[model samples]
Target: MNTPCDIPALQLSERSFGLLRSLFEKETGIHLRGEKRHLVIGRLQRRLEQRGLHDFESYCALLQQPHETQERQHLIDALTTHETYFFREPAHFQHLREQALPNLETRPLRIWSAASSSGEEAYSLAMTLADTLGPDGWEVFASDVSACSVWQAIQGLYPQQRLDNMPKGYLKRFCRRGQGVYTGQMLIHADLRARVNFFRHNLLADDNKLGEFAVVFLRNALIYFDATRRGQIIGKVVRHLRPGGYLYLGQSESFSEPLTSLEYLGGSIYRRPSCPAIARST
Candidate 1:
């Protein structure tokens, strides 16, 4: 179909907003309210033109085509914002380094960066774990709902400013400062990037054969969803964690329905009960 180049000031109609909302919810489980109408259209408009489409209506029709599955992927790329940086939450990293990693030495360690936005969080986990384990055989998998984020994570390159809050030791050890033509940017070492596998996944969707993980980081992302959906997503993730594994939530997020068979290990951390440690919650 012939499409027009993007019109920067293009207005989004109610019908267009509805189409964007449906696509977002289906792909990412993030329900965009009507208030975010402008945000969605503005961000995605340029991407439509990049794909050589002139208008949102044509993009919508493309998404509807059965063989245009790749178009839906592009829609996700355009719509989702991967605004993330290294060490985004310091306390979570501290806890992982001080408590979680030390406690996992006896077991085969596998961590899931469940809401790995832009790959920084997952790479951070891999760096911390690799530092602790030292070739002790551990794996980290980072997954995100955003197709663009997954691609960037795999690329392993980022702006230098993203490391503003990162510790000097970590900056030196895990990342190479951008130089020459690559000035003002940094890239994670291939060794570290090799340790993390980035893939597309929606938390609200069926669990793929993810196997089992020793720890699952389902932070920050839950804030976007309402309580009921959050609980459903949490329940699904916890099942893929092995017994005695850890589930970490965002500092501000809390569980309304306390998960059974998990011991509250203080703060927002919970540990799966090992064997007879279950205590019924009244």
Candidate 2:
């Protein structure tokens, strides 16, 4: 393993950066703008060093070879921003608890944490649903483009600090504090953990086998995509959103195009117009 100081400061050339950025967008739908040059360099430098490569050019070359699928995935995982916390955006959870959960008519209420990073948002959804809808009343499906993130979501172990923003009752009810050998960590209760299912999904791809959801939380992930791709992704996600279902975006994110099927419901929330009911012929 190479230490941070062991690798000399290296800058990604404009051509190399463009190459990598284009490749990343093509594979993952994440647009790395010119301003993110330094960020890309910082994230991928260690990967290059670990692979015993000298520069970004060589790294790009290696990625172009056939049967480098795993390598490409590793690159995507390295560049992914997994910044998230339990109930980070408090208002969204509050709305789900106060408004959405009560209105859902489905028997097994399903919620999708569409960009769940390291499980925080998904587990938060589980806690809220478990509290509001009871243990057997709901299911949370979490997906991420990063395999490593999906793996961590399945583990459901987190540092204690990550729970600071979570409600005290939820912390006590849905998770266990570590002791002695496992100090400073918390594990989500097995029952609550079991309620959430994690899977690897690329939003840019056509595999929408995850099924329709009553509420879809595609928060914070859309800011990385350009307008066209962002609209495309929202269209795909909306297809899996049931009629009258709620869709939540990060407070900072927005759709450039108007969606005829959805109506803005405030605080970065939108609702799909419910399909009209059919009348029975007597």
Candidate 3:
């Protein structure tokens, strides 16, 4: 299955690009094409240098060693994942404030930030929900595959720089500027922090039934998977959504074929058809 293009520029040998591609593909169902030869080398070359690996063969050997399990995860963490900011897609939050939350009558309204990289998306949700439902009525569940991101979310501290995308008034209201020894950081308000639960979870795998949620924000994460894998992952996550709940994808994504049950409300929003079974419970 190896192709000539998979070979690297400096190395005449087949190199470890095949092994790297296979590893990421297995873990995340993300395909690394043969043409990405330079990209593979460019991304991981620093890791090799840090570990004193002179060639791709040596890197592959290290990855195969059982003790290097955490190292492999570090590799995937670096190669994939994107930067997310508070209100990255501003319109979604606007819609939630003006439209969605007003209609829900359920107690303890649940929302899932399914790909909440580094907690901004989840915190935004918590802030809006707190504004709407107040202190006692709602909760946010935020999760990501990276252990590092989950830890950051739990700590609830961020560089003041990361709040650049946040609105000035909203920022002042929800965040506290670090002082003295803690300068240059912003700490999330304790109220918002308490409303969110952070955890490490891979969206490609089945998660334990935390609970059926009223809304799910899987945004921007599915673009990494191949089309077939995208369908499967979407289906699995949708199963956890309560009937009539909402699911939001990145604005760039649109479903076809089997996921047609969701009614598109434009701009990446979809509504799940209400189930008769849930109607009886209601």
Candidate 4:
């Protein structure tokens, strides 16, 4: 089973590619178009090499086995995870600070960062909430489908360059610069890290109950899915946002068909109707 692969010469056959694209779509609701084939190969090349598998076929075999949960996770991580940095979109966080916080009816306020990759968005929200809410009544809960991503987010470590987009004072106040072996990296301050919770959850499924929140940051990731899948994912996500709570999507993302409960506020911000006679599905 362990055929040594020539990493440079490795190729994903058309059959293997089709199987994988379908499998990934079935499991994660992400439609991998033809253009993403190279992206998949590049992302998964390390995984194939690590498994000592000579081809994508062998790797796919490993993933198909029910007992290969960890290996399957590695595949999902490689395909589903996308890199994100601190304050990737400052305006969304600005709206959270300026608008979302002022109209809270709930106690022990919570925010969900859906598809939170590597914790930047969650930690950024944590800092904003800590500054404005004074830490007692609020918490940020972040989840991603990739176990690797969730693990990285939990570690609270990142290269310092990724934080370049970070606002000026936040770096000093909420994080510490790496020294010695970690010179070019930074670690989120322990205090800020503690306020944010990171976990692995797939938006394609809704069995896991994350309590309702005052705001949900479900950004960028939606663009990868087809409209039907997008609707399903958004439908599941909106149920966790309390009526009157806000939802932030990527600036480029929006629904093909509007939900009756969600009212579009500009800048990719949306709010659930404060008075909902019934739950509305997208």
Candidate 5:
């Protein structure tokens, strides 16, 4: 009997927000501050409506119940941000093409797009590697904390607007323009899609089943964490980098702690010392 407009907005009290924030940090390593209260509420309102929950307290209560792992994951999916586009921070790709690709002795160069949301960064890596190293000479492993995002990356589809920043020849070579019912979307060419494997991975977890990489792209994702959490994540992810390998961060982020094993390479890049002893000893 109640009209949509008649229902009041869900109220998230200070206690509820604190509890939710703590849980989110514990699970995802993303620190939500007091400032992000509105952002959190905005992102989670749909979950409330979907579950027919009346208030934030009830949603919090639901999350606390046992065997709500799927619900908790849904909460994470709702709260985590996945804003990304093709060839974001073009300088990183340029450096990879001109500097990193040529220096590696490894025949089949391995690269990891550590937080490859929606496949743009991963696809970009594939394009560059495919062009530089040829199809069989390179491989890409892309992973994200959000299963929804991992699935999206696997699909290799995107809206036309997302490709605005993509490099000039890539669209023609590595993508197919959708037509008919699928107009306004683009799909990464099947070959390129096959080259990049997508998976669901939590950076906070210690399980490193993906193995080592010559280049690891951990870009634009560290801004969400605090200094300590940032260090924790960086330290954990750096373990998977092969000796002498490169790690790329967003232009805006910098390491708060001195990692003696990694030499500062400038341009928001760091290189693990080429000496195997350094990596082994660390």
Candidate 6:
């Protein structure tokens, strides 16, 4: 008579909770707050069932195996990927399309969606840039710590409702409505999908090889990190920004202390001073 919903959730003990959460923080730099205990249990419950593990303690043991890379990624994906949709924040894109690109003298016009979850933000940036830049060469690089999210993003498939916030023009220009057995689904247009590159990257590590970008959208995801880690992440990420480049954060995200690297430009936007201005001021 017990339905799946009626089945009691897997119990996570205080010791196992501390161990698993610490492992998560070490690998991903996200501070799993104590209040997120229920969320963690609910999200990770299936993983335990599928692994044939009876409890959270056993799951924690499996996670400790060095060769369990896929399982490790599953943990990260389950915990870190929050709800994201196309054009979630319109102002940042508007700023890029209307204000930043106009005055920008950079040749390549490279941009990074530093926390692109499921590729929505990156694709949004790509579509906006491709529409504006036309045949001119440009780059939109996006990365996430969640391997599963990276895989989903690379597929570029979504339910049609995901486009609700997308402008009519972009929907026509950048997406193809599904047909046949795939009804109610939409796919990012091949050209638009090709414009945005997706990869798996953890912000806790500095990937200097990605080179410099003219703008980096670190956005709303920073709220998951603690203050010290937030500063460390910002400092490392700023190293990738070209001089005069801009950084956009979520409107809700703010620092506990001043950031000496970038000048705050209001509306949660910050700009790095150009080389000439830096030299002149120095």
TM-score of each: 0.89, 0.92, 0.87, 0.92, 0.92, 0.95
Tens digit per residue, CA lDDT, model 6, 8-109: 887889999998899899889987888888888988887888898899989999999999988988899898855788887798889988988887778788
Q: Candidate 3: where are CA atoms >4 Å away?
A: 1-13, 255-258, 276-282
Give me candidate 4's TM-score against the actual structure: 0.92
Instruction: Write down the lDDT that model 3 would get.
Output: 0.80
Residue runs of model 4 more than 4 Å from their true location after superposition: 1-7, 277-282
Best by lDDT: 2
Give Cα-based local distance difference scores for all models.
0.80, 0.87, 0.80, 0.85, 0.85, 0.86
lDDT of 2 by residue, 193-272 (tens): 88899999999787756788999999999988888988888889988999879999999875666765677778988887
lDDT value, candidate 6, whole model: 0.86
Ranked by lDDT, the better of candidates 3 and 6 is 6
Candidates 1 and 6 compared: the better one by TM-score is: 6
Model 1 TM: 0.89
Candidate 1 local lDDT, 88-140, one digit each (tens)? 77888888888877777545588999988789889888888877788558889
Model 5 CA deviation exceeding 4 Å by range: 1-8, 276-282
Tens digit of per-residue lDDT, candidate 4, span 166-268: 8888888898998999899899999888889898888988754687888999999988888888878888998898888999999888667676678777898
Looking at model 6, the pairs that clash are: none
- Residue range with the least summed lDDT across 10 consecutive positions in model 3: 273-282
| Each candidate's clash count | 1, 0, 0, 0, 0, 0
**Preferred candidate (TM-score higher): 4 or 6:** 6
Put the candidates in TM-score order, highest first.
6, 5, 4, 2, 1, 3
Residues 228-259 of candidate 5 have per-residue lDDT tens digits of 87888888888999887999999988656666
Pairwise TM-score winner, candidates 3 and 5: 5
